[model samples]
Target: MSTVKIEKGQAFWLADPQEHDFPAAYDYLELLFVPEECKAFVDKLRGATTIKKKSKDILRASALPLLPDTNCHVKENLRKIKKKEKLSPILLVRANGKLIIADGYHRLCASYYFTEDLDVPCRLV
Candidate 1:
């Protein structure tokens, strides 16, 4: 697993997605897809290999507005980053010629606060 060492210390990412992240992804995906499809997507995400991608590129590809510092989730992720905690790799799905952030939107936004060029770990399917 690759770690992005920010000025404070090493902001590490887990080699595999956290167990809870899969259900989170499935839940979020349900908002966009049927339950059965959501499960399939989550399964694919689970089997996907971890890859590094630029944080800015992901935001652009997903067409998601960056959550501001005041966002509770973003704030929490920022705290984790500052404390040098291990973060879960994001889960992504490609559909309709667009990118969907299945999970870890807050982490991506928090990492972007440090540097848009930061290479964030993701399990893209």
Candidate 2:
């Protein structure tokens, strides 16, 4: 995808859709997925394994182009890391043989920068 497209995608997540301000994201959100369907998809991964691997490992596995630096999100995440706050695990969805970071890209980058070998907990969808 083009950088602009990726940025738009990132922005969609950053906007916190629960607040209900982004019509662009809300427009076809239901069409893209339904709760039951998404639940079924996760259920199908019953044998899925959750593992901790190097931050860089996931970046390589993602096969996705580097995301654009939007706000100071990464830096903010890094600050959190510096403060030693616990970060939630990143979620990944495997689609068409590529790992898409469904959430927590900034946290991943910050963890990777702190230490390339930082163990990041992740699970596939």
Candidate 3:
């Protein structure tokens, strides 16, 4: 994919998620839900429209810790940002008043490095 030109510390994102993102999300969701439930959530996420939210807010809602800059995955995402490569929109599941990051946790954490107020694009179900 062609890289996007970022300006003023803004991160770039693909207009829609990559095809592999769905299966990756399903694989992760399976850990928290039955296969049937995972399938349903993936289906819903596939049809969900992209929305923007602050990276810090998502972390707060999900109650997930921000991975450190030393993490391998987070480092990779940071490299992508430095290279001006577009990142895939994150996939999320909102249940029981919490947000589950089905995919793109590393990306979110990496984006937080730029700014906690950074607006992240995501598909939420």
lDDT for 109 in candidate 2 is 74
Q: List, residue by residue over 7-50, the lDDT tens digit for candidate 1.
A: 75465677888999999999999999899999899989988889
For residue 87, give model 1's deviation from the true position in Å: 0.8
Between prediction 1 and prediction 2, which has the larger lDDT?
Answer: 1
- TM-score per prediction, in order, is 0.91, 0.60, 0.92
- Candidate 3, residues 1-125, lDDT tens digits: the string is 22223578564788899999999999998888899999999999999999999999999999999998889998888889888888999999997777999999999998888888889999999
lDDT score, residue 67, model 3?
A: 92
Q: How would the candidate models be sorted by TM-score, starting from the highest?
A: 3, 1, 2
- Rate residue 14 of model 2 by lDDT: 22
| Candidate models: Cα lDDT each | 0.87, 0.53, 0.89
lDDT of 2 by residue, 4-101 (tens): 11221121112111222222222322345675654554443333465666788889998654343343877676556555555656666676576766
Full candidate order by lDDT, most accurate first: 3, 1, 2
Error (Å) of candidate 1 at residue 119 is 0.4
- In terms of TM-score, how similar is model 2 to the real structure? 0.60
Residue 79, model 1: Cα distance from true site in angstroms = 0.6
